[model samples]
Target: MLGNLIRYLDSVVARDPAPRSRWEVLLYPGVWALFWHRIAHRLFNARLFFLARAVNHLSRFLTAIDIHPGATIGKNFFIDHGFTVIGETAHIGDNVTIYQCVTLGGSNPTNGVGGKRHPTLEDNVIVGSGAQIIGPVTVGKRARIGASAVVTEDVPEGATMIGVKARSTLVKAETYAKEFMPYGTPCKEPCEPVGSQRVDELEEQVAVLREQVAALVEANEQLARKAEKPGKPACKGV
Candidate 1:
């Protein structure tokens, strides 16, 4: 138990930037919630349903993060901010990081009295703020969910999911695991500076414009050739 506590504190210190000391981690809502969740989950597995529910409710009230006692969460789970919701049947693997307002929720509430209503997040998964992963979808290992993405289906391993419908932008999570991404979104490769990206876009636009101009010039030359033919005459302006 002490080892687990130390590991939890260590994970927080290693992953997050704010905590200066181990004592400061005690003040973190995520830490507190996870701490309580460990006890609550144990009680839940022991068939102490009411006690587990009560503990979970208390944790939610204190942290503003709701994790169902029945949900199976693996070690080194980091919830960056509060207001993150994990449903009853949700299963989360090790080294999962979930940001604020992220929901691992069920799509069909009416058919809730069944198995695996909520989604499963595999190891090393990162879910950004305001992202909704609904239904019984399995988010593959090392997958990164972008902010405000709505995912309904299974995500492939090492894929970066973005946009409203959660479009997959292929990025190996192993490449950027050590690098701290603020909103959990991976930048495009050949990662240019803001000014450089703008310049590149302008350059592309200029190239396209040059091609259009050349095509127009060729069309004008063709018309000139037709007009200069022996039997053909140029049309008079209206």
Candidate 2:
């Protein structure tokens, strides 16, 4: 238990720049929430459902972070701010970091009583503020969810998800892990200019238009040649 506490503190300190000392980290709301959650999870695994729920309720009241006791969480998990929600069927992997207002929830809340409904975040995942990962999708390892992104489908490993209905952009996780962005925004790469794909699409359209124009010019020339030929005269208005 002491070892786990030390590891948790170490992880928080390593990831966050604000918490300077272990004492300060111990007082952090996120740390306290995780501490109680560990106890609640143990009771839940032991089939003491009522006690687990009670413990989780208390933790939520204190920390403002609602994590269902039935959810499975791996080590080195860090929540940057409060008001985060983890559903009962949600599974979080190791080295995961989540910011404020993040929700790992179900798409169909009323249905799937016995089945998995929430998302499963794999190792080294980072969820930005107000990001919602819904349904039974598995966000792959080392993936980063950008702020306010709504993810409904599975995210590939080492991918960065951004925007509503989340578009994925690939980035090497090893390089990303070296520096942490406050809102899970990755450093811009040279190859990825903003709206570059749209520009390429527009260029393709222009090329097609040019080709059509050239074809029309050739056809007009052929008609003019036929009209100028001997015994073939241009038609007069009727």
Candidate 3:
């Protein structure tokens, strides 16, 4: 219990330090997620609705975690940084690691009021940051939801969801891990560079565009300030 409290404090502190080392923050989020979840579950089961809501709101405010009071999360559920959110009816299985900005929500017309308006995630699943798993679908055990994906349908066991609308990029776990994910990268898929030169060229172009945009913005601001200033008295020819 004391350990959980310490972890929770660590997680809360992690968010405030943007410049802190990534490795330091990485460990706390997972630990704190499970800790808060235990408290939230207890409050929910005890029918302490107000207390549960308050705790939920406070956790989200402090950790960028937006878990609903009614969400049923299993043991060892790890919610990583980057803004993690779970809907009211989302059912999470054991040992699931969900990264930031991943929304496990439902789109049913009867949602927000009640009636099973969220997805069920099976055990050992890992959802990357910015992934959206919507509706009453089920993600099978050990499945992986890639970054920025939009999943609306059921995902089979040990499958991987990627791309818009979230198709099964790979169904087999071993192959999927080898192809999509990398080692020690915190649920990130190995980016398949189009080509070394191509990537470098695109990066260079982006840098140039950013510079131009910055210059234009600065110039515009200067012009606005000058326009707001009282008209300079007719400049002396001298």
Task: Please report, in order, the local distance difference test score of every candidate based on alpha carbons.
Answer: 0.86, 0.86, 0.73
Residue 90 CA displacement from its true place in model 2, Å: 0.6
lDDT of 2 by residue, 1-238 (tens): 8998888887777677665567888888787888899999999999999999999999999999999999999998999867999999999999899989999998775753658989999998999899999999999988889899999999988888999999886665666566654434432322245348769999999999999999999999999999987894478673
- Please list all clashing residue pairs in model 1, or write none if there are none: none
- As a whole number from 0 to 100, the lDDT of residue 67 in candidate 3 is 81
Clashes of 2: 0
TM-score for each prediction? 0.72, 0.72, 0.62
TM-score ranking, best first: 1, 2, 3
In candidate 3 the C-alpha lDDT for residue 236 amounts to 75
Instruction: Give me the displacement of residue 57 in model 2, in angstroms.
Output: 0.8
Q: What is the lDDT for 29 in model 3?
A: 51
